[model samples]
Target chain A: MNGTEARTIAAPDLLEMCAAHMRAGGRMQMAYVWFPQAGATPEIRYLASQGANQPFALWCCRPQPGEALPSLAKISPLLGWYEREITELGGVHFDGHPEPFPLVLHEGARSTLPPLDPRYPADQPVEFEAAPWRIPELGGKDVQLLPFGPVRADVLESAQFLFFYIGEGIIHYYPRLFFKHRGMERRFQGLCPKLGTVLAERVSGVGSVAHALAYCQALEAAASCQIPERARWLRVLLAELERLYNHLHYLGYLCHTTTLKVGEAEGRLLEERAKQLNAKLTGSRLLRGIIEPGGLRRDLDSAGLSDALEALRREFADYTARLERTDSHLDRLISTGVLTRKVAVDQGATGPIERASGLDRDLRRDHPYAAYAELPMTVALREAGDACARMQVRIAEIETSFALMQRVLLLLPAGPVRTDCHPIAASEGLGWSESPRGSLYYAVHLDQNGKLARVKIKSPSFSNWRAFPFTVHDSNMMDYAINEASFGLTTAGCDR
Target chain B: MPLWTFFGLTRGTATTAWPASGADNGQTGVLGMPRHYPDRCQDDCDACAAACLPGAIRVHTEASAGARLDVDYGRCVACQLCTEVCPAGAFAPSTDWAFGVRARTDLVWAAATQTAPARALSGMIRSTFGRSLHVRHVDSGSCNGCESELQALNNPFYNLHRLGIFFTPSPRFADLLLVTGPVTYAMRAALVETYQAMPEPRWVMASGTCAVSGGVAEGGYACAAGLEGILPVDVYLPGCPPNPAALIEALLLLLGRAPQRIEGGRLAD
Candidate 1:
């Protein structure tokens, strides 16, 4: 979207105008498609936004039933996943999709009804289709295939990785995940308004605050409800805390993967402290239950967080200094599993991954939500596009988040924590927010009863997962673990 | 390496003393299973159940029997919604950490009078695996909430190995099957196959509420709620995703090392 406001476009010019807009330097922010209960035709709206002066062109396309929808994946490979997602969920087929595969509803079981379809048989069994999406492989005679997991020794999320290798180095790897699909989006439709906030927090457990904020943002937008100023500041406070803890844990895990014991230990300790701090601030370690629609669930003392965060920031810099000084850590990360800027931009990578590749896109700055505009922040940037660069970006971001949090705490406005949020029946709205990893979004359509008719979530993981195959290509098989860890892709989020 | 080594030495150990002493864990606040008080429930009130996302809390009201509220902890995600919505304060926050039991019935804190108190494991079964326990974890369909705490078990603080609990890489070597997540249809075969791969005398511990009663994804068309019919679970440790401390308590209870502090939803005095 070019400007700050949203501009509506007719159904016919959805794809062509979007292509032209992008040609005119517009960015394809997200494409949200949904099934309207009363009608057979699905509503497809593509939000193309970029730059300060440009308005976000909301291209609402109504693809006639059985006709193939125009594919944006052909023009921008970044939208392949989104286009494929629309196909699987909205039951709209997009012509010219590079690889149109089922991202969530996999093939293997008995053929079942389309999960989110209005005509879906609720009582019927979810059987697999006769010919479902299959994992395809690129071949070479010298290449040997090795499978990694849907299950592993560690408490890793269930995801299978098939590494096509020639000798010790991988030529390419196909990751087959979503063995953890819990029909979350389907359940969201059936959830009560009050319960939506609770489950939204659990969308990708670690990003609870971000997801909750996104869900609430969508609800508030639909209802046109304004939360208290204090509530907005609290949201920022909790979000930054969530970011701090996740980055610590992610950094620590990356170190562990690379055999940097000291870095790993420091990361764990810092993450633990962050969790404890969160518990003290919000009554839960991961900051759950503190956020919901309208405002917070209840209020607690945030006074201690600033001091703890300051201490953490100081300690973090010292630990990172020691970490960077180590040759073993640096050697393993430097150019290991490099992702090019081209691949990142093409695949629409966000957060540290994009920043590491020199894209410098942080949704918090680009599209400010919550109290981000009030508490101004800087976007952390790096250009190496390596695992090390990703780590550097994360470390830098942690410091920035800490500083931002201190400012938010000092300048917090006092008011009510929560208020009544009533959504209008037969209304639809979009909510987007910057999570620890990247931009997280949710598109919700309410029924006549003011209940959720459908909710299509586009988590950061969904966009970032496309970069994985590119990242691991031709890299040493041993570096696979490091590459995976560096991306911080959540299998649960992707599967959802 | 020397500087880091020095830093590590100065920082010292961060391990917690749980089974040995007091293990401060992720147990405080609105995180664990709610302690339901049926007696305190408002007459014909369905607030908590109505507020429940997965229908974990059920209120059945008949003219003759009046109203009865039953909480299936396995289905509850510990969102503390029940605590917030219950006007009667029927659902209160609790500190009952040692929640593991051999029977699934033990996980149910009901509105009706208890018929069967959960019995300890059979002497023959306990004796077969008396010395130590090796767990093989299966991500049946977890959101990684349970997996995070499970990973914490290996971190510097918990050090689950100290308690003679080790996570094995293979089901063949595993003495106990520790499963997380609601049993999704995609993983149904994998779950059964993993159990099949395990040797005889292998016990099963349904770790989270999802494994025991399917948490929030209970009865979806694509997934099975809980592991009730799928497998015979020995230890039903119910929590949305039980904290590491709770897991420690659960394991200790399995070994008859820690006292079972919870019974019928409340802390047994």
Candidate 2:
């Protein structure tokens, strides 16, 4: 595949077009396909339906060879993965696809090809062969293969990374996940909207509010439900607080990883104080129960407002003082784990990772949702793109969030916390939010009965995971932990 | 000394001794819930039951009389949603935060019972000298919030280790297995395995709503019913995820120390 010519193929031109786009300096992002239900199709009928509210159309084609694959350029580069996914799951082959293999399921599983329809024999067990995965065996070279954990010494819910090292310097790192894959997505097949948000909340613990907000937004948009102004503002407040605490904790982790005691202590202090304030205001330390389907479950009173603001102001002041005294911590972070500005842009990194690389792209700023448009948001940027740069971006974000919280508190409108939300008769909508990890997008399709026909969540960790393989190249393996901590990628978000 | 140093010395002494005095006076810091109110109870409202995440609040409405709401202190996460959302302001958080008990039945508070007042001697003895506790955490497949807060205990504010409480890595060394999340099907085996590994003096503390009663994952094929189905949970900390202070109080209670309690509209002290 050359750069100049766009390759044309008879079988699924959409897949070929995606390959051509990637060959021509465009990166193949994400791709997945869904099938709509006509209520009669039986072969592949068990596949989930793309509800009415999703952004893209679910086009079904016969299992014949030679169809004009739609051009990939029409959709965002991130949609590339979706295309490959559709081919593998639906057996709709994309001719000239760079990597044509099964994605979600194991390889060589079933004998009879499942129809792309959603009404087929829903329980046919298919025999499939596992796909080949390369673990990069370093062998007898100076680079030793080290395996870390499917378990950690700490009580947190995550796996560890084994670092292959040469003396004090690390050569390679292997991250063992799947310790927390409880198959949440598989359970969403037949659930209604009211019950779906509960599942979304448990996807990742800390980002519960963000996930719930994104899921609700998708449902709301698909249903074309108008959220009250107060609900929107409260959502923004909760989201900013969520982002603030997460970023603060990330900074603390980064400092701790670098062995900077003072910085670690300060970071820990800020996090504790932030959580305390969050509980004082919203009642949940992690801000869980505050978010309900249509709007907030409860309202924040005047006393709550004053107490939260006062606590935030004091913490912010203390943070600034501590920052001045932690030069040694900053020294270790500045130039380590450098993901150059060019690489960050080409890879389409999002959130603080992109901001640190000097790419000034923020979902709040670019696609302003909720109260973010009302206030002036200072998107922090750093040219280094290293672990240190990432830390700086998080610190700046915390500062920015503190300012935003104050603004929201001052401008808070007097109104009811929620509006009466009714079941959607029939609708579909797209919902996206800038989670602490990055941009989180959800496409929701509602059945005629107002139940969730299908839901597709694109979490930031999916895209950021690509950057990890690239970031670790030619870098010492020991820095992998620091690099990963700086990124704060959630496996649950990605696996979902 | 510099001005900052002088201030630090003065402030450190003041702040360090505050927790000790506050604990003695039946105040559990800023995070602690206020004392519960009996007079303000309304016949119509069961606000605490509705707000409870773990369904720890049991409300019975009488046809001839007013409704009664019973809160199982063991099952309460101390999210304070019940206190905050209560319209009549009848519900108050117990300033006596420490309430770890030997039996799950003891944590259950009956709204109908106007029983003999809780023993005052327990609060006094517990406040004078803190107790030692050993915690073993089991992930029933959670989002890690409870674990994170538990980890934060090593920090300055909570300083759990200073109270003779240590978080052991292995179940063999554990006195209590602190479980979080609804026991998912995938984690059910692992939960049982961890429980079996623990020594005999072991107690299970179900931390989140998920752990106590399968939380949001309740009724799903992936989730087991709750911790009790596999192992008997002695204490229940009810929140989607409980606050760090609430957890500390629960731990203190387990070590034979009762947090300061109020009786008949008066502080226990």
- What number of clashing residue pairs does each candidate have, in the order they appear? 16, 48
lDDT of 2 by residue, A1-496 (tens): 0001222233344455445544554443233334446443211111111222212222223333434255352333344345554554455554444445443333333425432334433333334343444454675657665664433445666453666677656666555444454445444545667557756776777787888898887776665567777778778888988998788788777767777655565666667777766766765567765676677767875356656666766765665455545666566666677777766645557788888888776767765667777889899998888887787788788778778877777788878877656657556566668899887776666667776666667677766764665677567755666777788777666644
Over A1-496, each residue of candidate 1 has an lDDT whose tens digit, in order, gives 2123565555456567767876887677677666776457777777666664234566667777777777878777888877876776667788777887666666754433356676665435577543544656577789888887677766778878888889898887888766777777877775566679888877788888889988888888888888888888888888989999889888889989988887887888788778768766766666777788888888767766677788888988888888778898888889987889988877888878888999867767766778887766888888899999999999889988888888988888887888888888887677888888888888777888889888878788888887778988788888888988999888877786
lDDT of 1 at B226: 75
What is each candidate's fraction of native interface contacts (fnat)? 0.53, 0.25
Local distance difference test scores for all models? 0.77, 0.60
lDDT (tens digit, per residue) of candidate 1 on B42-107 = 876788888888677877644446338767665777777788888888888654545776666556
What's the TM-score of candidate 1 when only chain A is evaluated?
Answer: 0.94
Cand. 1 TM to true fold: 0.95
Where is the poorest 10-residue window by lDDT in model 1 chain A? A1-10
